[model samples]
Target chain A: MQKSYLMAPGPTPVPEQVALRMAAPAIHHRTPQFSRLFRETHEGLKYLLQTENDVLMLASSGSGAMEGAVVNAMSSSEKAIVINGGKFGERWGKICEAYGLEVLWLNYPWGAPADPAQVEELLLQHENVGAVFVQACDTASTVAHPVACLGKLVQKHPRTLLVVDGITAVGAADIAMDRDGIDMLLVGSQKALMLPPGLACVGVSTKAWEKISQSDMPRFYFDFQKERKALAKDTTAYTPAASLITGLHEVLAMIRQEGLAHLHKRTELLARAARAGLQALGLELLAPAAPAASCSGARLPESLDGKALVRYLRDTMGVTVAGGQDHLEGKIIRINHMGYVDSFDIVTALAALEMALHRFGQPVKLGQGVAAAQEILLERYPS
Target chain B: MQKSYLMAPGPTPVPEQVALRMAAPAIHHRTPQFSRLFRETHEGLKYLLQTENDVLMLASSGSGAMEGAVVNAMSSSEKAIVINGGKFGERWGKICEAYGLEVLWLNYPWGAPADPAQVEELLLQHENVGAVFVQACDTASTVAHPVACLGKLVQKHPRTLLVVDGITAVGAADIAMDRDGIDMLLVGSQKALMLPPGLACVGVSTKAWEKISQSDMPRFYFDFQKERKALAKDTTAYTPAASLITGLHEVLAMIRQEGLAHLHKRTELLARAARAGLQALGLELLAPAAPAASCSGARLPESLDGKALVRYLRDTMGVTVAGGQDHLEGKIIRINHMGYVDSFDIVTALAALEMALHRFGQPVKLGQGVAAAQEILLERYPS
Candidate 1:
């Protein structure tokens, strides 16, 4: 019998208790019980987002919330700056263009960290830019963007709102939304929240709400104003995804119990271990400039089909890891260490990678990667 | 100690097995394991939607899918017919208006059904109408529109695509999308899919795809064409709610084992029982023309506050039900019987309502509503 290990970037493993909460009977959205639950979830999200703003909960995917930020923050004819470094960054430009906004795209090479100095130059060029759309960490490239520096820089310009898509960054990193002067910080539930997808939380600053108040973009279901009004009453404007919220409450409690600093450190250690393991196996890091603490992307070894390696890990060993996307497809593989994951998960992924590579006709030591990961983990976890 | 009973219109109780599956480690989205799971989910949705057309999965709430149908099927300078009967029906107009479509509104009473003949007249009057936006069942009023009749009526207009927001109807009722010529049938996972509220599935007809191809409306995340192409390879266009999809596999398995006819009959029987129980308590049915089998909305009896009644039931007895929206607030209460629920749930809700009424100085005979519901349930489910 083969045991399964899931190490995907977004839909990471959910805690056992959290999953049990999701299975519990759903409460009515309009009832007092749900209202109380909703309030707790709202407050918990604020804590998770590290913001004083009333984070609005949406029954949508991360992309929907991303779209909400664009439409709510700027009108159709306004100008915006988009940092297009990877797949997710390109998404910002796409959402902006879809809404008829004039997007000034700042192209950065994939697997390369975004340059804050270049962003400063563009912001200076476009004085009337309504918002600056960016990803805190481009998940596809596994590169952590310099959001802290960018946020500090963007705060200098009062006219532009810094909207960060922290889908894979928020729970995995220590970039504080309020402290960093981020106008809008968006996250999906499936990532470090240790819950399933279907819920998105966006923390909006008072400054962003001011712009949202004046924006003329057409919106109804994703309207932030309606969400804010309902949020004050401890409910959602529409029916909130009840089970996911319940699960989120449990995950947030777990995060609280563990403490955010500890959580971030844990993820960082796991990421470091994975990186050490891949380097031990003679694999090149895909994003060496600044790797995300959530996932590690490594170039595929010679004579190994990236797709075949991933398939062998899943089918032969029952371990799931992600292959690269777009241009990097079939050339790289990503191992995730986010949400409900620990050092052992990294060991399993590395061990599976070694076995799969061996099966794919590569000459390598069986436990070299896992041994390298263990050495790093032992120093950090000390168990 | 209070035992909880979920009787909400949506976000219904999830089965234990399904919840456990959702809590399971999330597999990689692009892996063969997930591809097979996705393929099965796609097939299961087609079966649930009762449509031969391909069902596209989305990572948004029902409203997002509703918006997808609107923006993907019609351009900005188009005219559409909207049936405004209740909150959900009015949502059709809201979405259409948000996207800048000229909507010919057919206003019906909030609790009343749409007349097919009047719709025919509107179709004739507005020959240039490109689509008809409607809800199979308006959850706010618990009114199930005659979608089969409307679909047949709209089918006559070759240029007009029939878009039905079957958020609470597709799995609860027996309307066949292909058989009725529904161009677009949208449903949320939080309803009868027995899952959380983050995923939406839209089944598109060939005619709808034709209109979608010609639609010049700018779309990125909710793009149906991109979704179709990705679906052909057994994956979603964007990162799908992976855990929810995992839970969905379990829920669909349960539905298949029980059979659709049995599932529908069970919900119909539960709705009938709830209606009988409320009527026995001297409460008026909100939608007598055609009530949705998913929920039963009742006008509160004398000396009862709708909001207080719902709150008391939830806070005191741990039984959560819904209060009405808009003008119906504090006047109507809705008892849900959708998805992963049965006769016992209706009885529990009725008993709670009776107890709450007694506590609130209203003369309520204890067990009266429960007894009435038990009789109907026994007659239908004589095991």
Candidate 2:
């Protein structure tokens, strides 16, 4: 059986060390051993999130934190301006709407990141908006939303919390949530954390907490107050995902050992090589924004179906990639270079894409993409 | 570092193998590999829950599932009948109250099981009750709440779903969800599964489904309908705790390999031997009515504090026995012999307990507990 290399966004390829951590002995959550583990994890998460705000560690997916962000930060007293350009941005709107929060939507096409000017314009127009949700790098668009700029402008509206979904962005990008005026930065472990998705971490600003106290929405499992109280005791509000925590411990230790800046640089390098290689193959970038940017959406020639190409890459070349969701399915393909990625991975993925496109009868130059990627790598990185 | 053995009901010791499985690579939730894993896990969960109901999984702790049961399974047309005998039981009432549901609580004293007669009487008296939530075993009390009689009685009120919090009960005891006619059987992976506490799995019967549809509670993250829909698609409604799921895959495989029947017998044998050994050491059990079936919840002599004994167990012997909670603290030391345990583990725990007691100047004899435990094992196995 040919096992395809998972190059799509999280769950990213977990390091063997982290996976081993998860498979190790289960520690009692309340025991001193686990408390020390939990305490260390809390410290590590705060460092990753770049915040002094007490983080709410959840045992659900990224969306659970999204729901928590919405229910805890926004109330019926004011509307939330949801700038939806991608799937996750749309999700923020849907979750808030489900809780009966009035929404002021600023939607854009799926391919491009929402303009910061557009979001700032929306915030100004919708004065009643108490919160604004944006995806730092919306996975569907593969474009890095200008959250630091947008968050700064939203800070002007003190009542409007700048809630950013950093699910695919946080550890992959230079995210200083505290420095960026982000009120609530939510991330899942599966993506940039280089672990599985069972653990969700939220970086909350004091501004968000003040809103939480006054929010009339009925929040239970993901309640900030409950989570805060638990964190005060150096534990989770609920029995936490212990193995995931162990994985987190391992992943964090790996990152710390490697240095966060070094890890981020590696991801940037990987994304750069992937983008350079894909461009050389005559594929148009769906969003050619930055190395930190993901979805990493690319379009095949109009004659070739992107969906079919995704399968071809997987079925033939042993490289699993992502197909576009909703309207972009047959038009766009996503190549993920988020966590636990190295230069050789880029070579393997490019080789697969080249082979798969060749099989599709595309008039392509063999090994041209790999050569181009190597050229850029040689020029930029000594090794 | 003195590595301690976890003697808590949950976040129990993870099997060496399960920990290894959790350390596997993190895959994208949408990838074909994840699709295969999700499908395998969904099927594995159904078999483990012993129910044909839609066994939905969550990326949260067991408390999340308990909250899900409260917010999704019970209808607003009627009140929630909660049986509070321990911390978990009180959780049912708290969750119900959080959803603004009218709560009818039948609370029993600590260290005692909820009487089925009381549950039946409450259901009969309150015809408006839509559901009754109880524990199969109260870990805080170390008392097994017999669900056989409660299951039979709750059957009469088919509309009044019987929700069993089997967090500490699932693999530790002989509680079968389907055979017992349980509408909602909730289990946390951290306890009897010998895994960490990141995932919460629930057995939702068809009756529970109908009631869920009628539920007026507003929920997004814990919504059963959304989760069930995602389950049908062989994916989680949210990004799951993939590491936890990976760990779970390994743990369940081990369980199925051991077979449920044999596991139950081993657990019973271990529990019996441990309890008998403790009793022979002159420790009096707190649950005089039921022999404290799963965990050996016994009070040390007045000269010893359970808390200090627990500390000594950890500090001196590397055995982390649990001290009683609430008013029971310092009075009773609960020795856990749940998942990932066998004869030697119980013997080690018993010997540790005896040594800890001896250090406290309370123990009457040496090797007495081990000798008694040996006799039980010999008589039971006859080998």
Candidate 3:
């Protein structure tokens, strides 16, 4: 019998304990039992986000929260500076345009991070800028932007807010929302939270609330102001994904036990090991300059079919990794390093990659990448 | 040791097998395995909705789907007729008003159903009427509107489509979308679907699609057209709620095994027994005119503290039933009869309610409600 290993960036393997917790009987949302769990989960979210701001939990995927951030924080009269470095970055521009906001796009290569200096120059040029939208880590490109740097630049502009989609970065990386001047920080449950893809938590600063109050954008289900009012009473404006929230409570407890510093350190180490393993296999890094701690992308050999390789690894070998999207499709493979993953998980991924490559007619030495990954991962256990 | 019971209107108890299936390791959503599961789940949704139309699964609560139905079906150039019978019905008007659509509200009492003749009159009077929104079963009031009758009336008006919020009705009651000429039918996973919150399924008729094609309402996360395109390829426009979808696959299979007619009959029987039980305890029915099969609501005695009684049942007696919402708050109690609920569950709920009322000085006879409920529930067990 073959075993399956989930090594994707966003829908990483959920911890068994957390999964079981979510699997428990469903509870009524209006009861005090739910309110207690919600309150605890909200506090856990704040700790995970490294912010004292109000973190509102939503019932949709992360994109819904991204849309809420736009409609809540800005009006059609203002301009939105969107850093389009990858698919997720481009989504910010699309969402802005969809909401009737004029978007000034700063286009960057797929594997490249957004330059904070360029963003600052755009902010200085556009006087009516309401917000600058960027991804702390874009899962599509596996690139981590200079969110803290961009946060610093936008905080100086009193009317402008910095909204960062930390879907792939929040629990894995150490970007402090309040300390970094992030007006709105978004987190998806699936990625570093080690849960499913339903709950989206957004940490909103007081400055962001001020903007939200003034913005009369059309919204109902994802209404931040209404949710805020409900949060004061320890409830959500609408029906929450109660099971996911329960899972979140358990996961946040796990994160707290591990501590943010240790979690970030472990994640960075895994990312480093993944990068080293990929490099050892003679594969070029997709985001070598600023690789995200959540996952790592690497270019396959020009002759090899990366799409076929990924499918083969998944279907034949039972090792699930992600291939590239858009322009990079059929040319790259991405291996995750975040959430519920450990040193051996990285080793298993590298080993699977090596075997898949060899099977695909590439002259690859078996165990070569694993050896390199082990060298970096060994630092976790100082013996 | 105390045993807990979940007897709420929504978020009913999940089947043990379904919960265990969902608790399995998370799978990568972009893979072929997930695509197969998604395709099967989509087909299951169409079967459950009793329609051949495209049933789109969304990652939000039922309200989000209601908003999508409003924004996708009508533009600002047209007027919408909203049946404000309960809290959910009022939400239709709110969503319409939020999106700048002119809403013609047909206000009814909290526990009353919308009149189809009234809706027909509005359609006849309004030249540019786009759609009429009503609920098949409004959980708040436990009222089932005459959806099929309204469908026949709305179908006569080509420009006016019928949108039914079947959140509590789709799997529990008989709603033939295609046969009834319903343009849009929405379902929430937490209700009759026997899954947790986070997934909302919408079945759209060809008429609704024609309207959606012409509508220019701004939307991003809940974009129906974009989702339709992705659904054609066995995927979603954005990242799906993967775990919930996986659970849906199992739940739909269970629904298929228990034929639709059988399921509907069972739900109706349970609802009738619940009403009988409450009546036996000398409580008035909240929606005697048109009680929904998904749940049953009953008014508490004026002298009894309904809120305190409900809290006591939940906290002290380990039973969870929902208190009323808005004006009905602390005056009524709603017991669910949908999803995985059976005869014993009904007996347990009524018994607990009886004991709670007695404890609150209502002089309720212990097991009096249970005896009444069992008499009606006895039809299921014929020798």
What's the distance in Å from true for residue B117, model 2?
A: 96
What TM-score, over all chains together, does every model reach?
A: 0.52, 0.51, 0.52
List candidate 3 segments past 4 Å from native: B1-383
lDDT of 1 by residue, B1-383 (tens): 11356788988887767876886778999899999999998888888888789999899999999889999988777798899889988888998888788999999887899998989998998768889888899999999888889988888888889999999998898878988889999989998887888988899999999999989998899999999999999999899888888888887877878888988887898899899989877789999989999899999875567887788767655668999899999889999888977545665577557656666667666555655675576544222
Cα RMSD (Å) per model?
Answer: 26.1, 25.9, 26.1
Candidate 1 wrongly placed segments (more than 4 Å): A1-383
Q: After superposition, which runs of candidate 2 have C-alpha atoms over 4 Å from their true positions?
A: A289-292, A379-383, B1-383
Instruction: Summarize candidate 1's per-residue lDDT along A1-383 as a digit string, tens digits.
Output: 12356788978887778876887777877889988888888888888989999899999999999999999988766798898888999999998888888999988888898888888998888768899898888899999998889889988887789999999998998879998889999999988887889999999999899989889998888999999999999988999998998898888878887888988887888899899989988899999989998889999975667887787666655678889899888889999988877644665577557656766677756556765775576554221
Q: Can you write out model 3's per-residue Cα lDDT over B1-383, one digit (the tens) per residue? A: 12367899989888878888997899899999999999999999988999999999999999999989998999889999999999999999999999988999999998888888898888888999999999998899999999999988998888889999999999999999999889999999999988999999999999999999999899888899999999999999999999999999999999998889998898888898899989988999999999999999999888878898788878776678999999999999999999988665776577567656755667665445655665576465332
| Model 2 lDDT at residue A322 | 84
Worst ten in a row by lDDT for model 1 chain A: A374-383
DockQ of 2: 0.01
Q: Which number leads on lDDT?
A: 3
- lDDT by residue for model 2 over A1-383, one digit each (tens)? 12347788766888867776787778888898998988898898888888888878899999899999998888887898888878888999999889888888888776666678877777777768888898888888787878888877988887889998999998888888888999999989899888877889998899999988988888789899899988888898898988998899888887778776876776776677778888988988877653345447787788987787887666654568887887777787787777776544565566566656766688776455655564444322221
CA displacement after TM-score superposition, residue B217 of candidate 1 (Å): 1.5
State the lDDT at B349 in candidate 1: 73
Between prediction 1 and prediction 2, which has the larger lDDT? Answer: 1
- In TM-score terms, candidate 1 sits at 0.52
